[model samples]
Target: MAKDKKGTKKADSSASARMSNKDYLRELRRLHVEIVKLQEWVKNKGIKICIVFEGRDGAGKGGTIKALTERVSPRIFRVVALPAPTDREKSQMYVQRYLPHLPAAGEVVIFDRSWYNRAGVERVMGFCTQEQVVGFLKAIPLVERAIVESGVILLKYWLEVSPQEQTRRLEARIKDGRKIWKLTAMDLKSYSRWYDYSRARDDMFKATDTGHAPWLVADSNDKRRARLNIITDLLSRISYEEVPREKVKLPKRQAPGGYREPNYPLKRIAEKF
Candidate 1:
């Protein structure tokens, strides 16, 4: 590994140059193959996995998740991105809404944004009281401990982005039509209250960063590198091997004896392409 101008060790020499699309795709494909192997091992061994991804907006969590699951079976690897709690949910225990979505046997549940909302957005935006946030932080370790003790493999990731890069990403979202949906009024508010969010994050880490389920922080200034690094680290952490399988050959097609094309006219859409 070589050092970048920032003095951080680059994952590879390619970081010195504009990492070409070709290299990105090639590396992604290699990782996708390993992900497939992990998926198979999980299903075959009835391994339960729960992966939590949390970060500031535009920290590349969604893109990293897409790269992880694009080549894997959705049945085995499930993504849970819960929306704001409903009225009933608000009345329930803070963690109650998230409890039902945890991984079952032979399943991998990935939370795009998870229970840490109380520690981050909710507390910063006044959705949760200071006392409630404190209580949740204190109780979260017990909840996570139970999950891990119940034979579940839990991994929590917090993607860290520099304020400058965060600003550039949010500004790009404002200009790019395709990404406009990602920019919300709340985001603008959060952008202005960066230090407030920082304080909240520090508090959350102090309380909930436990040995049972420790938080893994990833630097996400470079989206491509961040995705690859996260995926590589995830694969390395999990203990899995390629499950053996028997080869299959395609059977010969059945011969058509009396089947004939229907005479009835049917409407078909024009193919402009």
Candidate 2:
């Protein structure tokens, strides 16, 4: 495998190639089944799993997460996408707000974006001081080590998207009503500082990517392939079996027993569709 300038293996073009809708759905169905099995095993065995996703704007993190979690129980597979820090949170320890949201027993908590904000957006966007960034970079590995030692299976992912693809996605967001909200002023600012973000990401990888909790980078140029690849990689990292289950049988419903329908006039909205 040829290595990129970053010393990581260049992704095989064919491997990360886009999938047809039919093939994407077919594979997704299979993965959804496996995800359900993993969910059951985690619940049955009281396992704790935490997944953190980090990436540049328009890198498909949200889409990847949506695919990864859409088929699972929200109670079991919780997604935490916290808003900007409150004043109190800003005053408190940087990691304090995030700590409370870590996975409990029998839970698979996923952070759409996580504590590494200080290293990436916060640093590049001047939301935090260089000293604060330095401190966070230094302390995070130890914090992660503690989280691992405490029996939480932590998996971190960094979605790597090409600059051209990112531009396309962001531009689409401008013209698409559904995605316009995703393209914020901050996103525009961040887009301008592409190389700045790259530097920050490189530093983050160098500092926090550790043996206990390594950062897994995924090529996200093809949104469909990225989602499938990420979900597959996630399942691979965790050891789970299909928890045993009894065959399900639908029970017969009882007769209405002369329950007459009420004649009240209910104002129902017109079914335009």
Candidate 3:
């Protein structure tokens, strides 16, 4: 596999055949167990974690996040996919709106898309001026340094999907009823400017990929492998030990104390399945 400028391995588009669904699920189940352990350790140790996911449209960010958090507690594994900024938010500092969403002790916050929006979409889609983009790129590394120094374990991921695979996924979204909502006008607009996004991504990586919090690139052409690979990488980055647990036996229930079932009529919905 060829390495990117940052010395991270780029996803090889032609390397392998698709992973079998059974094998994928088996591996995912194992990872889920480990993720549960990570969750428990984070909670017990009061470790705050912040994970950022960024990529072009149809890059499997949502799916990967789902796989990562499916078996975890929602209270601890919080997913933040913020809507477009409101007028008041637009008036505030770009990163200010995001800081409030950072993880607290005992919480793991995952950003489906993050503050790097300015360096990616906002820059490529004409949403922000070149000057603003430059200023953001210049200042974000220092901001991230402060965030790290404040003890938040930050992980930023860039899911690199090949153009062919991205096209296939987007087309599938167009035809799949469940995924139709994933395709939007913005996605359509962004789809036409692939190289624009590529350039913007390059610049963003150069600016924000620091030693304190480096950007990890995952080849996402195969969604299953990408999800597993990212999850494995995430677990490796954190120094979490499995928290010991006490074995439990269910307490015996008391006999019903002369309580009888009520005769009142009750409403019931049909079990269609």
Candidate 4:
């Protein structure tokens, strides 16, 4: 990933050109096969893995997570996207709400947005005190160190999108019926506070980018390239070899001797498509 003078990562060169749907799907399906192998390896080896994805709105975090887990078993590769904290949750330790969602033995947990909320949204917005944000920045590294010590492999990714691209995507969401649900009031507010978010992100990377759990920056202006790059990088980090399985043979179906088909008519919904 390349960064400009501002220290913000620039989108990949490949993002300049649009990716055809055919090529995207072809490569995506190929990676999906590898993800299935990784899933099997994790389960067979009882590996504990946690992946944290944090980024600006419309930065393609959801899409990337969807691609990563779509072909894998949900039970083994779980996604945790916590909603706004309740009053009770707010009162607990800042990291406490996230701890319970950590990966157990043989499981991989992917957090759509993890505790770094204190560093990004919570701090940039008025949700948390500056002191609290500062405290979290100092303390989170220790928490992550403990997580790694407990035999869990932690990976953090920050998806970076240019300001123009982000605005375009946000506007597209407003017009696209399927994406309307993704555009929230908070997102609208966050849009205007770009510089605030940038400063917060810089401060966050400075404080929490530790030796144990460093941040991996992914340029998401071109979503297809970003997805492929992320998945490829992730797979490289985890040392997994495809686990051999006994060949599965479908047993022949038994013939129903003297069984008569029912002639009863049932109402069916008209096919709209």
Ten contiguous residues minimizing lDDT sum, candidate 4 = 12-21
Per residue, candidate 3 scores C-alpha lDDT tens digits across 219-273 of: 9998999999999999999999999999989999999999899988998899999
Predicted candidate 4 versus true structure: per-residue lDDT over 24-138, tens digit per residue: 9999999999999999999999999999999999999999999899999999999999999999999999999999999999999999999999999999888999999989999
Cα RMSD (Å) between model 2 and the true structure? 5.8
lDDT per residue for candidate 1 within 247-268, as digits (tens), equals 9899999989989989888888
Which pairs clash (backbone N, Cα, C closer than 3 Å) in model 1? Answer: none
Of candidates 4 and 2, the better by lDDT:
4
Model 2 pairs in collision: none
Overall lDDT per candidate, in order of appearance:
0.92, 0.94, 0.95, 0.95
Q: Estimate each model's TM-score.
A: 0.91, 0.93, 0.93, 0.93
Worst 10 residues of 3 by lDDT: 11-20
RMSD of 1: 4.5
Please report, as a residue range, the 10-residue window in candidate 1 with the lowest summed lDDT.
Answer: 11-20
- Residue 98, candidate 3: Cα error in Å is 0.2
> Which lDDT value does model 1 have at 158?
93
Off by over 4 Å in 2: 1-17
- Candidate 3's C-alpha runs over 4 A off are 1-16
Error of 1 at 130 (Å): 0.7
